[model samples]
Target: MFNVYITKAGKYLPNEAVSNDEMEGILGMINDTASKARRIVLRNNGITSRYYAIKDGIITHNNAQLTHLAIEQLYDSRFTKNDVELLSCGTSSPDNLFPSHAAMVHGLMDNRSLELNSSSGVCCAGMNALKYGFLSVKSGNTSNAVCTGSERSSTWMLADKFNNEVINLKNLEEQPIIAFKKDFLRWMLSDGAGALLLENEPAGDISLKIEWMESFSYAHELEACMYAGGDKMDDGNIKPWQDYQAEEWLKQSVFAVKQDVKLLEKYVLKLGAKSTKIALDKHGVSDSDIDYLLPHVSSNFFATRLYDALLEEGIDLPNDKWFMNLSTVGNVGSASIYLMVEEIMASRKLKKGQKLLLIVPESGRFTYSIAYLTVC
Candidate 1:
């Protein structure tokens, strides 16, 4: 069996930072009620801060641009563009609805010696891409692979429509100005990018090796969360809307998580590793076994739900460790898990020989992917 190791990982956020109070100021001018609602919404979601791209930025800093930057940063000076045997990009936004983002990244990197693949199955794209890349390496078809996810929620956000319809539904006549301010923009959304470089280690530095990857899709729960193109108004501006049934979305997400945990248990058994044995395995050795978890940042509520479930299964975790970054990052779609990995590594908290568990829960036709990694 080929052992696929993560060589490097990196993430980039836009230069500007948006805070909650600023968002309220922007909303206050448009509709005081909407501003109040926005505060409640953000508070409920547990998102205090996020990043956005500047208007004059070279790259749009959307999903594709973020992914590109991440890959470039991770592989800096270590490998030439041609050393990459495959490139995979996962995102909800397509470059134009025709050409895939993978092709765009490949062209940007001047990578001419690899097959390119793209994934767009909503939030699960990143995990799916990683699994696909791992399979390619395990099958001996590729030696080096790059998987990336970039998201710019700001560009896709229709501030006027979002604020008007969702927040100030009762008194639209009171606030008429389309006030677009930093505060409102901050609460509206943020952008970020993350990438991982994987390779088949013949005998060199191996950061983390993938032990197993599993995915389960629950198709019966489609439409639990959705996005629809909006009708053009007389003013000629296009709008978009979210179709979310919060209660049902939560149900499916929980189900998916349950299934994912079961599969993870089975994989651990296959590897001769049990939940109880994780702690006693090793100390500081390069391959000493430790449980390092990286789960998808779905929502504050869902994160807690998963935590409870893990606790029920006797999976002990340090307080505030598993879902630490979700409150700040929000739901980053496919980029959440990878970005969590980046955050954990940056903190210098993970020791060698630790086991990292990555769980990704995607909405709408809910799908869950679980990956096991051993820190090297």
Candidate 2:
């Protein structure tokens, strides 16, 4: 089997920062009951702070701009545009109905040799794209690839529609807003972009080499979370409210994680990599055996639940092995796993010869992906 390595990685966030308190104030300006609005913000999502694109200190940037900036940060003039073999953008937000975000990124790069593709698998686009890209590289179809996942949820958020749903200020004061409007708005929304460059050989500072990649889909639960039929103004808006129900998604997510672990166990056993007992042993030496762990950043709640599930499986891993920065960056959909890998490498924690395990759970259903990496 051929080895696929991550040559470089980059992340970009809008200049303006929005804390929970500021968000509450903004919500209050549009809603009558400011206190109730604040509570709504606190209870629904565990997000404390998230980055936003800004125009003159105001939070706003379209998908095109975010994609361009993220790529620029990743490329950093190290390679010319023509050097790129594949340019893929995994995003829920595209600037237009046609041309696709991948085409837009290609134009931004101004390179003629780049082949472009776009994916819209919600938050899982990042991991799914990587799996596809690795296959392309292993098949000798491409030697270099760039994968980017970007979103500008703030632009799509309809604040006016949200405030109008508040029927009675007194009613809100007495009870929680049962309106689907506010809850949906808070749930399936976040903004940021992450880009990664993959090559057959190590480039600059090598992060980790890709040893294996796999993906599973649970199409039966597709309707568990979905968005359909909206104009350009409301483009990419998800619906049915149940999509943002974290508790419901958690059950399916855990099932996916266990399934992926079983698959990984099979892969490792086939390759004679490690015995089942060694892999699941409670000893802290598992860290010495496998250098790092990068799990999907679905949410803080999801991360905690996944960690607990791993413990139940007899996989003892310290908090230090987990690369979780969602509290600082929020969830960048598919970009979350790759971004976590970048964070771990940049922190100078990963040493040579150590193995890293990458895990991602797709939202809305019980599907997951697992990949193993070794530091080169």
Candidate 3:
């Protein structure tokens, strides 16, 4: 198989940065009351500023538009839109359910028709798209491909979306706030897009040589931990959005993102470390092989916990060797790892032969995606 290299990386972080004090204003306050969980969530996530595609409840860029903008920035003298043979896009918060996210993104580009692949998942969706592009080029099916991971999370975080749920809870004489499962995510997610251009040859003075990409799913052993478009039943089964009546949709807030925090606390880090150890062992990669570690963490609350988990697995990488951008960019779901890569590449801090390990944990179903890339 031919080797695939990341020729360039680009990102688009919607409008100006929105500060912590401004988030509720933009997303609006549910029931005209401040979110009891917002400050606590933000404090733990450690995100001071984040961008949004919406301003004053108006969307400036849909998910497709954000993805398209990031892709447009990938073109240069060595690569143009016409040179793209494949377009793969991934997102959990897509604009529509009918047209695939990749299709919608491809529609925005003024280029010839090309093969499209859209990956559907939470955080790992981005890596899945990257893996698809990497393999497409490695297999010689395409000489070049563009892959993107993006999220327009603000669209779903709007307070109005939860109004019905709050009202329903009030009528039931329960605490008026939405469940912590759904309300906490409002302060954790951000809107942004990041893209990678892959080709048979490396571009510029430095490029990332895709060594190997591996993914693990513990779904067989674990129940869903994070989800949307469905309601979690008491039996731990997910009742899909389509299964509910239209009125029940708004009443239950079935479409709003939610997480089983207890499940996340129990399995997220443990499964991630387990999967990472397995990947490293399968490839004969040791802790010393990793020059830099890029991990996509949903909240900084898990940062030190993640380090400890990795140590338990015998991967002894230090804190300094780790690279993260969550504080500045917030958690962009599938785009988080891509954004981390984009900034690191732009920093020009990597040296030849240096190895970077990217770990993305998806609480959606205890999935983990680990990839190794070498600077060349």
Candidate 4:
């Protein structure tokens, strides 16, 4: 098998950074009233600023465009877009349902025809895309691959999307306030895209050698916790958007992202830590061997909790070794990990032979993905 290395990392955060106080202005207030949960959620998530792809109710860049922009930055003296043999993309929010996200991204690229793959999930989708690229190169099926993760959540979080629900509720003389489940995500998510170019050989003076990657799902024992484009049934099943009538779509804000906060509190860290221990043991990598911990923490609220959970599992990595950028970038779902890795690589803090452990936890039915890399 060939050894695959991440030769370059690129990211594109759309437009300017929007501060916490300016969020409601861009997203607009629901029902002309500020959200009661926005401040509380922001305080807990610890996000100071974030980006948006919207301006005056018009989308500046769709998910495909954001991804294309990120991929363009990956080109340099040694590698270019046309040199890619495979392209794998992942995202929680795609521009359309018919054309796969990868296909749309490829359509925007000024490159030759290449193999494409699109992974669909919440946060773990990005890692899954990277895994596909790594394996394709390892098996000698391709010499190089470009993997990306991006999100354009602003399109769904706009106040106009929720206006219909408010109108429907007011018509019935009910409270005009949207549910906390729906309002909670508005202040928590932002727009961005990140990409990685993987090649069979290490490039430049620094490259990350992918040692191993593992994924685990507890869906067999858990129910969905975070979702969109569907409604959750009482029996723990998600009813797809197509299952409901057209009128109910806007009235229910069916496409707006929602989460069961209680479920996330119960399982996200516990399941993630357990999976980390399993992957470490399976690969014979001890916690002490990890020089850096790049965790895709959705919020700062879970940072201390996750550190303690890993301790409970006999993995005692210290806080100094942890790395995250959620506070400045906001939660970009699948793109979070890629952005973190890109920032760290640009920082030039990594030393040769150092080990990097990446953990991505998704509360969507309790899923986790772990990857191990060595600096070369």
Candidate 5:
């Protein structure tokens, strides 16, 4: 089999860590609904703090810039930008529709010679990008590739539609109770970027070696589970594309993630358990053989439930083997898996030959991907 390995990893966490208590202030003091909503989200989501990459009330970095900085953090003077043969980028939040985020990163690097690729929509965008780079190397299409999952979630999370500001508590009881599903993530979603460098074979050193990867999509049935687009007018039509105004749209066009709690309760855990089995069986890996579990669930609500579901599926993983950063990082969208993987590598606790199972489920386009990695 062709060899593909991740040689290095890096990340760019935002400058500010907004705690739950602090977020209550941003939600305004209009009524108790905001306070009650905050408690429900944090309690259910398990996010004590999350970050925002904002500078003077503006987005400090785009998907390309965030990923670019992350890749730079893994910089090796010996292996310059010229050594990179290809770039594969994935993101749900891109600066512009055309040019692709990968191409934009190339432009930001001021190095346009390398071939570039990108995948968009959903949190799984980043993992999908990794798959492209992995296959490229495995198929002998390219040797040195940079796979990145980057998101400037703060841009959309704080968009005008959901971020309502109230001055004083004059009419505290007048405001309606918030539809938690519609606005839950305006505060829950954090911002950051993460990256990994891959090669056909081990270079100077290796972080993780690829064993097998499997991804499937249920987008046909799960469309609009999480999405971003222009708002429709009351006249039962969308504003003409040419008439679309950026300033107005930026304020009202929120990236919404509204899911029926029952639907998630019914299928979320099953997807995680089933995907784990599918990937492991395809590669002939026994459930008892796993040394670690890196789950990319959006919240602790799902993480806890998925843990039990895997047990029912006969994969009894110990608690210590489970790795998650949702409490501190929140849901960083497409960059969640990359950020998790980068942090694990930085810990340097893994010994050679340890098998790590990375479970990825993206609701954007509803792609479920599982990656098997071994320490080298």
Candidate 6:
């Protein structure tokens, strides 16, 4: 049987750092409104700063360039163009609807001659894209593949739009709940990119053996939490999700203005833990077999809730054994798990012969992906 192993992990975060103060200032927050919101973000997410592709109040790097930089770092001298037989990428935001992010990255790498796959949707697209690449290797279609996930989340956020409207906790009773609810996540979202070079046979000194990978999407029955849909046209009429007659979505702008926080808090961790248990049981992976846990909890508050839920399920993972950089990176959409893997592997925290479970739960599309990795 063929096996796929992650040979190299790499990540790229914008050099431009955005602090909580900077975020509040950008949103045009005034008086104590910014402080109150900042406190909530800090208390809930434990994020103080995150990098962005913005410069002088303008977005500089698009999704494609970010992914390219990450992949470039993955190449390092160990792997070359010939070693990469397939390229797969995924993102919620893209540079262009055509050519696909993978094709654009292929063009950037000057590897137009090779095969590429680009998928677009919500945050779960990243996990799906990697799964596609994993299948590509397990099926013997390719010996090596480069999988990438990148996002310029700042561009898709609408914090600046609701800056003046957000009320402070001091005036909690004075404003509508939607105002604070809508503003909660936008400020915490940041930007980054992550890439991984995988092969059937290990090429580098370290490798993460692919033991099990599966994704479960439960959004069909759940209401959309955060999304990018049709914005208003010149006449102020909202376009449909996709417009076939016009050949364009007419989405002059797509942003998240509202989210169901109650819905998210209600089912996110419970469903995520259930999915984790399912994968663990299916693969016969025991709690004792796991040496590390990499969980991409979108918010810091969810982190505690998820920990409690996992404990109830009888999987007690210590805090030190869990690796997360959300405090510095925020929620990077599809790029979250990739960044986790890159940081973990590069930090030397992963020794040979350790089993790690990567838990990725995306509220944007109500999906859960649990990947069991054996480090060697």
Question: How high is the lDDT of residue 251 in model 5?
Answer: 36
Worst 10 residues of 5 by lDDT: 162-171
Model 2 lDDT per residue over 1-376, tens place: 4568787777777766667766534323334434443455345446677765544435567787777777776655667667789887887666787888888777777667666778776666776667667777767789978888787765444344344334343345644242333344443356778877778887775557877665555544232232322211233223332444454332222111111223222232222122222333423334456667776654554555555556655565678777777777766666667668768878877778888877666543444666778787
State the lDDT of candidate 1 residue by residue for 1-376, as single tens digits: 6899887788887665557665444323333334444665576567777666544424345556677778877765667666788887887655556678888777677657688889886667887788888999988989878887766665444334344342443354443433222233234345777888888883234377887777766554232333323322354332332343444332222111111223332232222122222322322212123366676654464455555555554555554445357667655667777788778766777667778867666543456677777777
> Which of candidates 1 and 4 is the stronger one according to lDDT?
4
Give the clash count for model 2: 1
Listed in order, each prediction's TM-score against the native is: 0.72, 0.75, 0.98, 0.99, 0.86, 0.86
Better of 2 and 3 by TM-score: 3
State the lDDT of candidate 6 residue by residue for 99-159, as single tens digits.
7888888888875477788877766778878988899998899888899888887765534
Q: What are the runs in model 3 whose C-alpha is more than 4 Å off?
A: none
Q: List the residue pairs that clash in candidate 4.
A: none
lDDT tens digits by residue: candidate 4, 6-38: 989999999889899889989999999999999
CA lDDT of 252 in candidate 4?
A: 92
List runs of model 6 lying over 4 Å from the truth. 27-36, 158-178, 230-254
- lDDT of each residue in 135-179, candidate 5, tens digit only: 998988888789898887665544343433221112353444434
Q: Show where candidate 4 strays beyond 4 Å.
A: none
Q: After superposition, how far is residue 237 of candidate 2 from its true place, in Å?
A: 17
Runs with alpha carbons beyond 4 Å of true place in candidate 1: 24-33, 55-60, 160-189, 202-206, 221-223, 230-290, 313-323
Q: List the residue pairs that clash in candidate 2.
A: 53-60
What is residue 3's positional error in candidate 4, in angstroms?
0.3
Alpha carbon lDDT of each predicted model = 0.60, 0.60, 0.93, 0.93, 0.74, 0.76
